[model samples]
Structure formats: C-alpha cells, structure tokens
Target: MQMTVSEVLARFVSETDFSALNNDNVVAAKTTISDCIGCTVAGSATEVGRIVRRVAQSSGGEGKATIIGGVSGASAQAAALVNGAAAHALDYDDILWSLYGHPSVTVLSATLAVAETEGASGRDLIQAYAIGVEIIGKLGRAVNPQHYEHGWHATASIGVIGAAAACAKLMRLTEKQIAMALGIAASQASGVRRNFGTMTKPLHAGNAARAGVFSAELARDGFTSSLVAFEGEFGWARTLNARTVPDSDGLQVMLGKPWELTEPGIVLKRYPSCGGTHCALDAMIAIKDQHNLKLEEIERIDCDASPFAHKVLLYPRPVSGLEGKFSMEFCLAVAAIEGSAALRHFDEAWINDPRVQALLPRISFNPRADLEPAISADAVPAEVTVFARGQAFSQKVLVPSGDPRNPMSTADRRAKFMDCADGILETDVAEKLFNDWERLDQVAQLDELLSPLRPQN
Candidate 1:
C-alpha cells in the first residue's frame, strides 16, 4: 500500500539523524543561523518589533525562552512569534531560493524557542532545522511560480508547516503525533501578497513561527488531526489553490535523497530590502561603479525583468521607507546616486528626499518574459540601461550576488553581520557571538549562546 504524504514525511522526519547531515550543509546551516541572529538583533529597535514585543509581554504565560535583543522572556510560542517578527522586521534575513521565501526567520525562530524550552542541545536544534528545510524546500518545488503567482505568501503559507515539523522534531513526537501537528499547521497557514510592503508582511513570519510551536505542543499531548491533510479534498494543497497540486508519490521518492538545504542553498542579502529588487539593484550598482556615473549625467534609466519581479516591485513612486524597499525605481535610483542602499538609506526622510523624488520618474520598468524560463523564482534576472552622458550603458544580471551560484565570502558575511550588529551589541560581544556561531554545532544549549544577546539596560 502507498503511504500517505504525512506518513512519508513523518517517517523521514522521525528517522533522520544529525550525523546524516553533510559537513558542508551543516556549515551552511550555521552561516544562515548567524545571519538570522544579526538581522533579529538589529531589527529589535524597529517599530514593528516594539509592537510585537509589547503584545508578547502583556499576554505573558510561562516564561521559557528569551526574546533576542529584548530584556524579557516569554513562553516558547510567544518568543517564537516575537523573534520571528523581529528577524524579518527589516526584510534582511537569509532566503532559500527553492522555498521562494524567507525560510530562516520562520524556521529558526520556532526551532530556537522550542530548543530552549525543551532544553534540547545545539545538535538537536541543527537536526530540527534540517528537517524543516527538507519539508519546506520540497514543498516549494511541488507548488511554485504557480503557488506564488496565486498571491499566496509562501513564507507564511508553507513556512508554518516547516516550523511545525522543526518544533515536532525537537519535541520528539511520534510519527502519528507529527502528522497531527502538520494537519493543525495546515489550518493555520495564511498570508497574501496583498500585504507586502506593510507591517503585516513581517507579521506573517511571526504568525507562522508561532503557529508551528503551537501546533507541535498541542500534538505532543495527543491532539488529533487528519493524517493526509496535505492532499485531501479540502486540504492545504487544494484549498490554497496551488497551481498544480503536489504528487505524494513524487514527494516520497525525493525525500532525503538529495538534501534541499544544500542543493539550492540559502541566499544571503547584500541589501536590506525585498528580494525582488536585488537583480535590478545589482545591475544598476554595477553600471554606476563601472562608469563612476553621477546623477546629472543620466537622462533616463530603463530596467527589464520578469513579470513576477515587475509585480513584486509594485511601487514606482514610494512615499515611505518601507515602500521604498519594494520599489525597483527607488532602489536603483538610490544605488546610482548614493552608491549604496544600506540600512541608513531606507528611511522616510531619505525616501522623500528631493533628489530621490527627482530620480524616481526617470526610471522606467519593462517586463522581460524571455528571462523567466532560465532562472529560479527568487533569482530575478534584470537588465538595467542608463542613458547617461548622452550614451547608453547597460548591465545584465542573470543571478545576483549572494546567490548559491554567486555566494558571499566569509569576509562578506562577517562584514554584513558586524554592520547589523553595530549599536545592538558591543564590538567584543558581537565578535564573540559571530565566533561562537561558527562552532554552534558543538554547543550544548542554545540559551547559553543567546543569553548574552538580551539588551543591556
């Protein structure tokens, strides 16, 4: 008899061992986790971070985990909720290409919180993370450009299930209990593209992370749910309107054969903005650097990308910093004029600056359906042309930097971490944290690593 989708996954999750993970994959996981911590710590001071922290504080239950960069503790679920939000608050966390979403914030936030709560070791957390990555990465392949095109936010829609899987692994639930956790997670999956560029966007990550912990804890206590919720008539795949419903047979065959975490790998961000805008930013920045181009020398900027990028980068004339992050026009213009679109650049004052406003209208975007077939969904292929100095200079980017094919160096990763960790942590503490993360697999407890991260009064 053929096994149900949940049964196949339950066996895979239950049977997988940390020792089975490749050394390179384990290194990738540590790098991704380190990047996530930097983002979460830096994001703690953001407006959205404060709001969630406030909510988590007021609704306090048993305090079992620490909120990164915050002074207090909360229940594992609540900490996951707030930390998940904080991690992606600046839209700067690591992204998995296959998942087509910010996977680390959603998966790590829940896994870390639960690890601390269960007194699980660092090795246990790593194994749970690998499990989550396997589930979500495969789901992304099964569902994709179609699922994303349907206006569903995969980070929340699919991430909740991955988070649950990670939490369930840490809890050591039986296969039946794991299936129940997945079913419970399916009901909670939600988030839409319509909410992009708003505070609610990051909230999706938090909610997904929280739901994972919630469902796993309930399932550990013998809570019941459908074993085949992924493929049932009213299940996640059908209900979410997946472009092509995933095949259980195919999914079962693919599990653990080639691990997803290392196959597509995670793409670290060079810019602290939406992934949609990176290709354009890369092309524009390259052109600017090559010619040492100045703003006045440019008459118009033309950018070409796939329709998916055109749609995600919806804002042509962004009025706020948050909106600026998603605007191709704003990001390219800033890169061309300012030479960098660093964290300090995406503020309301900078977004509404006279120079930025003047440059926005000069940039025009066009759809390039031709480039869609060759690249991954998260890989935005962009060609940017600048009509400057009465001459046209163009750069075409097939895969932006930080992509697996074009990976960031160890120095690049460290520089980014320090830039983010500045002001949030003392220099020595930040350096030590980064060093500690490099050897994270050997650490016994996550709390020992995270405890010093609490904001000093």
Candidate 2:
C-alpha cells in the first residue's frame, strides 16, 4: 500500500535512531537547544513573556515542565506556551534557511515540555529535536517560497507541525498516532507576516508550540485525524495551491542522507531584530566604518536587497521599537549611528531619537530589477552606498553574519548567551549552564540543567 505524506513523516519519527545522528549534528542540536534556552530565559523578562506566563500560571493546573525563568513545574502545554513565547520574544532565536522561520523555539519548546513531563533523558531530547529539524527542513523545501510568498509565517504554520513531530517522538507515540498528530497540527497551522513587528509575532511561536503538544497528546489518546491530511484534496497542499506544494519524492530522497543540521543548518541570530534586515545592516555598518562616517558628513545612503527583503522590511517610518525592527531604513540608520544593533538599542527612546529620525530619509531601498527574476531566500544579496565627505563608499554582503558559510564562533555564541542571560542569571551560573549544555546529550536527566532556569524562591 502506498503511504501518504503524514504516514511517511510518522514512520520517520518512529523509526529514526539517535545513533543515526552523527557527532556534528548532535553538537548542532545541543547548541540550538542551548541558544533557545538563553533566548527563552531572556524573553521571560519581557512584557509579552510576563503576560503569557501569568496566564499560564493562573490556569491552576501543574506538571513537571520548566517555564524558563518562571516558577518551575507548569503543565507541559503551559510550559511550552510560555517558553516558546519567551524564546521568540526578542526575535533572537536561531533560524533555519530551508524552513524560512525560527526553528529552535518551536522544536525545543515542545520537546522540553514533553521531556520534562515524561522525565525523558537528554539523549531522547537530542534525538527528538533532530527528527523535528529534519521534518521542518524537508517541508521547507517543499512548501516555502510559494507558501511564504503568499504571506504565511512559516515559523508558525510549518513550525506547529514540526513541534508536533518532535513531541510525538519524545513521547514514544506509535506511527499511526504520529500521523494523526500531524493531521491535527495541519488544521491548527496559521500565522502571517503582517504581524511581524508586534507581540503577535512571538505569540505565533508560542501558539505553535502549544498546539503541537496538544495535537500529539490528543492523538496518543486515540483522537483520530486523516492519515493523508498533508496531501489530500482538502489537505494542506491543495489548500496552499496545486502548482506549489511539497515535492514528496524530493523530500523522501533527502531525509537523512545529509542531515539538515549539518549541511545548511540553523543560523544563530546576532541581532535582536528581523532576519530580513541583517545583510543590509551588516553592509551599512561596514560602509560606515570604512568611510569613518560622521553624522554631519553623511549626505545620503542607498540600499538594494532581495525583493523578499523589500516585502518584509515594510515599515518605512516606524514610530515604535518593534516596527523599527522590520524597517531596513531604520535598522541601517540606527547601525550607522550606533555602530551596533544590540538588545539595548531597540527601545522607544531609540525610535524617537532625532538622529535616527533624520537618518531614515537618507537611507532608501532600491530593488534591483536584474535580480528580481532569480532571487532566492538563502542568498539575500544586499548593496549599501554611502555618499559622505564627497566620496561614495559601497559594500555588498552576499551572506550575512551567523550564516553557516560565515558562522558565529564559539566565543561569539558564548558572548551572545551571556548578553541574553545578563539580568536572568549570575555570571557564574550562566557560564556553568552553557558548559553543561555542551554535554547535554550525555546527562542522565534533563532537569538538572533546566531546574536552574526557574526563579529562585
């Protein structure tokens, strides 16, 4: 009998072994998990994170799952909701190019919630996360560009399914149940780019994590959904469109041959803003440095980027910090003035500063017509031109920092972890936790490290 997409996904989830993952992929998963933990911890301190945590805690049911920096032991779904929101609250979570969304938060938030509830070992967490990455990466190849072009936020729409797969694997669900879980997730998948610069964006991540856990739990208890929910007539593919959908044959051929985590892998974010703005921001910073630009000397700046960048960086004159993140003009203008787009730099004061406001009109996006037909998301080529001191300085960045080709170093990653952990943890505790994460797969219990994430009574 021929199987459906969900069946194939379910079997892959049920059959893949931890031993199938090589050392490098395992290390990548560990780093992603660690980074997510830091992001979640930092996010828990945010206004949005606090609001969600309060709601979760007020729900009045409790389990063993950790809520990052909140009190320990919320129910698994509640923990997933809070931690997932926190992980993405700062827009600092790791990203996967193929997936075209934030991958780590969805996977880790759901897996850890389930792991804690089951007292699952670290190896189980690692294995489950690896499978989750594979699912999202493969599906990204199949559904995105078209799906993304249509304005679906793959982070939530695709991520919910990926999170469900991870949780199902960790829970040791049967193959049939896994298929049902994915079908259930299919109905729940939804988010859009219109909410990019608001609390709703991170909330999308949280919703995916929560729905993923709910889907798997429901399926495990014999809740039924279509086995072919992914490729059926009324399923995800046709709903998306007939012309653009997952390439089933392509995905099956590539499943684990070259693990997604090892090849194109997740990119760790260096800035606390939309990934769409990174390349241009990097170019503008480089140009500013090379020209020794002064605020007074600058005349105007010009930028050209991938058309997708144009679509994402929609805020031309942002009035708020969140809106500023999706504005290339604002990001570049700020980088030109501040030399860096650090976590502290994104605030109401920065948005309203006269220097930033003045620089906004000076920088403009010019979409190159030549590259329009051939643009792809992975290679977001950007050009920055600065007319300052009567000289034109130009720089182009084909690959932004933190991309696998131009990867963040171990020291850089650690520094980022420390930066995010600043208010949440003591320096010593933060350092120790990072070290522990390096050996996470070898640990006997997942809680030893996660327990520290709870607020001290």
Candidate 3:
C-alpha cells in the first residue's frame, strides 16, 4: 500500500537530521528566526499582543517558555500562542509565496516554545523550523491559489500542520506519533480571509501556533487520528481545498529535494503591511523618488495588481492602523507623501491626516487579469502609474525589495531589526540580541540566549 500524505510527511520529519541541512539552509533559518524574534519583540508592544499575552497568562500552566516581552514565561502552548500573535502583530513578519502566508510566525512560534520546554539547542530549533517551512511550502504548492482564493487564511489553515510537524520533531516524537500530530492539526486547521483587517488576523497565527503545540503534545501521549487525514475523501485536502491538484500526489518525493528555504525562499517585509501591498508600494515609492514629485503636483495614482493582490488588499479607505496595513490606497498614499511607509506611518493620526485624506480619493486600485500570471515564484507583480504635472510616470515592479531576486542587503536587514526593536528593547540590549541570533547556530542553550527578551521589572 502507498504511504498516505500525512505518513510521508511524518517520515520525513522523523528521519531527517539537522546534518542534512547545508550552509545556505542554516543561514536562511538563522536569518528568518532572528528576524522573527525582532518582529515578535516589536509586536509585543501592540494592543493585540498585550491582549493575547494577558489571555495566555490568565489561562496558565507551568511556565516553561518565554513570551518575548512578557514579564515572565508561560506554558509552551501559551507561549507559542502569545509569541505567534506578537510575531505577526505588526504585519511585519516574513512571507513565503509558496504558502501565500507568513511562515515564520507559526513555525518559529511553535518550535521556539517547544525547544525551550525541551531544552533543545539552536541547531535543533533550526532543524525543526526548516522542516516546518518545507512541509508548509510543499502542502501550499499542492492546493493554492485555490486554497488561498477560497477565503482560507493559509497562515492559520496550513500553518497548524507545519507547526505540528515542527513541534513533533523538536519533541522527538515517533513517526507514527508525528503522523497523528499532523492528523490532529489538520482537524484544527481554520482561519478565514474575512477577518483580514481586524485583531483576529494576528489571532489566526496565535491560534495555529497554540493548536500545533497542543496537537504534537497530544499525539506524543498516544492521541489517535486517522493517518490518511490529508488525502481521504472527507480529509483536509479534499474538504478544505475542494480538491488537491495532481501535484499533491507528488509532494512525498519532493520534500527537501532542494529544501524550500534555499529555493524561492522567504520574502522579508520592507514595509510593516500586507505582502500584497509591497510591490505596489515599491513602484509608488520609486516613482515618487525618481520624479521628486511633490504632493500638490500629483493628480492621481493608479495601481494595477493581480487578482490575489486585489483580494488581500481589502481596505480601500481604512479607519485605523490595522486596517491601514491592508489598504493599498493607504499604503501608497503614505509612501507618496512620506516617501516611505514605516511603522510610524500607520497610526490613527496619520490615517486621519488632512494630507492623507486628500490623497486617498485620488488613488485607485484595480485588479487586472493581464497582470495575473499562470505561475509566479514570488508575490504577483504590480504596475503603478502616477499622473502628475501633465505627465504619466509608470513603473512595473516584477519583484519587490526583500525578495530573493532583489534581496535586502545585510545592512538593510540589520536596520530593519533595529527599527523593530527601537522602543521595545533598549538599544544595547537589542544589539546584543541581534548579534547573538546572528550566530544562532553556535548557541548552546536556546532559552538562555533568549533571556534578555523577558522584562527586568
């Protein structure tokens, strides 16, 4: 009999050693992990982060894992929940187009929690994270853009299974137990795009991270679930995805063939907004800088984006910072007026500014079938046309900054980390954390290295 999808994935999770990873894979894992920690620390200061942290603290267990900026620790599950939300709270976490979602938030959140609880080393954490990204990326390739287009939030929906696999690996679960964990995680898979512009958006990551850790722990204690949960008639692929494409059957052979982390790779965000907005933001910012166009000279700005971008950028006229992150109009307007859409530009004061209000009406975002490609290695391309001073300045951005093709410089990544860490951690402390994480593969104890994240008070 053929191995089921869940079993195949579990076997890969069970058998693969950290030694199988190459230098690039380790570097990729370290970069993404460090970036995620910075994002988590920064996001922990947000309203959603505070609320989730409070909830996790109230529903307590033995405190075994760090909660980034919390005063103390929580259970692994609770810590994953809080940290996952914080990682995505600013919408600043990394993205993988293969998953069509933020991958690090769920993967790192669960693995870090479990690693701390198990006293796992940095290499162990790196191994689990790599496996999680691979599983999520392969599974995503099998079902999306159908899965993503069907109103499912891939970050939460597909993320739970990947996180489960990561936690199971970190916990040293058997292959059968790992399969059970995937099965349980498949049952828990759910998050909708309808909640995109709300607090519930980050909660999706939190819920997936918590459910993943819980699923893995349950499976370790002999919780039973159908091993064929991913490919069965009423299973995850069939029910949630409607139908898996032909590629779904071939995923078993494809796992770690080249390692997902080193291939298309993860897209670290240049702006603290939706990934859908980055290409357009890049185009707008470029046009603004190239022309040195003043706000008064600008007549109108129009963005022609892929169907995926159109669906994800739902908020046209946003009322708050959270909504602003999903608004193409708001993102572009800020980029045009302020020359950059940094974390400081998404607040209520900026949203309601007279200048932003004046520009919002002049910006138009539309979905054009022409821009939609049959296959894309990165986020779909976007075309921006800015009309100003009786002249049309048009730029089509095929790849946004932070993409592998247009990778951010080391200085840029470090700057981003420092920017995210600015107010959340003191400068010297943040510097030490960044340097330590940069050498994560050399670290002996994961929790000890993360000690600075806890509040001194």
Candidate 4:
C-alpha cells in the first residue's frame, strides 16, 4: 500500500506503547537523556562549540527550539544541528556498541529540542528517545555493520531513521504515519566516513538528527514519500550498500530487544577519545599505575587491534584534535606521557607537543584478526604493550570500563552527571533532574526539568 510518510510513521508509532515497556527500556531512556545533557554542556564550553554557535546564529532561520550551550537559540532544525554536533564535540558523548555507533547524541539532540518546543513532559521525551535508540540499533544491526566498513556513518544514516521514528512516536502519529516517517527519513539519510576526525563528522550527526525531525513534521502535514523506502528494489539498502544488505524482516528481530543500555549493551565512555583506543588506554593506564615509569624512560609503545580497529585508529600523523582522538599514535602518545585522555591532553600546545611528536614514530600498531576476540568475543578487541627502561609490559583489555561487561555502577553514572553539570548547575538542581526523570509520567510541566538548562542571569 504505497502509503504516505505520515501514514506509515503513525502506524509504527501506534504499536509502541510506553506503559508496557520493561525496566531496562526505562533505564536506557533515562541514562541516554542524562548522558546527552551532560555531553552537551561539556561540549558547549569547548572552542568548537563557541565557533559553531556563532555560525548557526548568524545563519538564523525559524526560532523554534533552543540550542543548548549556544550563543542564541535558533529554529528547531538549526538548534538540533548545533546541539547534536556539540554533544559529540568532545568525542565523549557516549557509545552504543550494540549499534557500533553513537545514538543518544543524534537521537536525543533533535528529540530534546523538539520535545522542549512541543512542551512534552520528561516521560514523553524518554519514550520518544527509546524508540529512536531502538530503531537505530535495530537498523544498524540489520545492516550488519557493512555500512561502516563501506564508509557510511551509522550515527547519521541509521540515526535519521531513529529520529524520524522518535518524532513520529512523540507526535502520537499512527502506524501508517510512523512507517511513512521512516520513508521520509530514508530519503534524508546520509553521512560518510571520509569526514571522520573533523568537525564535519559530528555535524553529519547533527544534520541527520535535525533532518529526521523535519521529515516527520512534514509527513504529519500530509507529506508523502516512497512507501517501500526501506525495501524497494531501488530503495535505501540497494542504493547505499554495494553488497547484500539485510532483509526488511531483519529489523523485527531486535526491534524491541531488552533495552540496549542495560547489559551487554551501550558502552558509556569514561574517556574522550575513540572507543577503539580504549583498550590501549586501559592497558597504558594500568602500566603507568603499576610501574610509575617516568615518560622519559619509555622508549616506545605498541598496541594490537583487529584490522578494523587499525583502520579506525593507527593514523600516523594527526594535525587536528578530531584526528587526535582516533589516532592510535596520538592517543598512545598521550596515555604514555599524560596517563589519560583528559581534556588537558587535547590542548593545542599539547596536541603539537615536541615530546609527543617525537614519540609518534616509536608508536606502532599490531593488527590481528578477530580470532576468538574474547572469552566470548563482542565485536571489538585489543592487546597493548609497552617497552620502557629495558622492561616489556603488556595487557589485554577485552572490553573497556564503560562496557556492559565492566559496567559503571549507578553511583558512577551519578558522579559523571555531577561532573558534567558542575559549572552550569548546582548539586540540588542536578539532583532534581536525576530524580524527576524516573517519575516523569506524573509530572505536569516540563519546565522543572528544563529549568536548569536556561541561561543564568
């Protein structure tokens, strides 16, 4: 039934009832929202955020939603664009390993902007967010991660579908409308890996998020798009993928799997660099702690990652901060020299440091096949070694700290929230946000939660 976008989207949304959601679903929704809020605030204070904010405001469009951490509010679409990019500015927003991508940054950035403008309650916001995250996760899994290998940005491509589903669900559209929204989103889906390590990479995420919202709104107003935008012979998979892609029914397999944030799930980063580099950082930090080797004593460092991991990291020379985050060379250099990829490691002078630059050549990568990556392999794996003062030390990190394997405790999440909210909000205000999100269904007004985000006098 070659239905319109709104018709299709509404149909799918009607099938997703929040009250019936399980505990994991609820928790995923809550943490992702809180995580995005934290990342957005942290990103806003960065130089990249400052620069992008000015550009967004200067190109002013409709004043629909506020761009958190920006110079001024812009239209919903514009705000989503800037806010989404900023949330990931530190390359530390959060990661959903299930999807092998970043979701909350894209889905929530647009969803939050729209929810605030639509006056939706916190409960409404979380429901929409879960739908978005779920949809993106399913879509990414369906694609079998080939798209990423083929150089398409999953966060942007799959994220567009998620945002559309979210917007359609939040707007209370019908199953048909929801399906159509997916169609509309398919048309707008795009993002490339070539832009990795650049502002444009995150901007791609912002674009996908904002575009999905726009697609949904248009669909709601009787807009139309291809009915089989996802499955048609000439549809998304065929056009975007060079090899065989997952069948449409593949989407149903994990469409509503137990919430992805709970177990064997999303990896909330404790560091601000590429997830690929985490195992190496994990190894290096432990070595530094055990031996207390001065940076001068370290002759060289070595990291072993799967071929795919090497492709993502292991860049020989990095000229920018974005590149620095993914550079095994750069990240290894910092971890050995500075002990962490904290904000301080990203300073301009530090990025170009003579000592770090000198060590770059000594840093090399060992590429291994994913042969039984772990006790039970989970996609990514690595082993790192260090040679310092005639002693060779090595460690293997099957999963990083934030992985569901080595999950962060709730208290850890709370501490992170507190850190992210420090300068912008007091403990009481942040506490309110953490507590209220759970009881959002009973909340009347959205202002209580949104209050902390407003610019102070």
Best by lDDT: 3
Clashing residue pairs, candidate 1?
none
Q: What order do you get sorting by lDDT, best first?
A: 3, 1, 2, 4
TM-score between model 4 and native: 0.91
Candidate 3 C-alpha lDDT tens digits along 1-457: 7788888898999999999899999998998898999899999999999999998888768767998888555799999999999999999999988888989999899999999999899999999999999999888887888888889999999999999999999999999999999999999999999999899999999999999999999999999899778887788987887336423348767999888898879988999999888999999999999989999999999999987788888889999999999999999999999889999998999999999999999999989887785543367689999999999999998789998789888889889999999988899988888899999888889866788999887
Model 2 agreement with the true structure over 1-457: per-residue lDDT tens digits: 6767888888889999899999999989998888888888889999889999999899877888888878776888999999999999989888887888889888889999999899988999999888988898788777767787788888888889989999999888999999999999999988888998898899999999999999999999999999778887788866864235665566667888788897788888888888877888889889877767888888998998878788777788888788888888888888888778988877799999999988888887978754342322575678889888888899988788988888889899899999989988999999999889878989989888987888888
Spell out the clash pairs found in candidate 3: none
lDDT of 4 by residue, 43-97 (tens): 8777667777778788878664777755334677777887888888888877876
For residue 77, what is the lDDT in candidate 1? 89
**Predicted candidate 1 versus true structure: per-residue lDDT over 1-457, tens digit per residue:** 8877887787788888898898988988888988998899888779989999888878868767888867545798888999999998889887887778999889999999999888988889888998898899888887776777789888989999999999999999998899889889989999998888888989999999999999999999989889778888998898887766667788878876688778888899999999878888889998999999998898999999877787687688888788888898899889988877799888898888888889888899889888673334658788999998889999999888888789999898888889888887889988888889878899987776887788666
> After superposing candidate 1, which stretches have Cα over 4 Å from the reference?
373-378
* Global lDDT of each candidate: 0.86, 0.85, 0.90, 0.74
TM-score (all chains, Cα) for each model: 0.98, 0.97, 0.98, 0.91
- Angstrom error of the Cα, residue 347, model 3: value is 1.4
Summed backbone clashes in each candidate are: 0, 0, 0, 24
Model 2 residue runs over 4 Å out of place are: 247-249, 369-376
Better of 1 and 4 by TM-score: 1
Model 3 worst lDDT window (10 residues) = 240-249
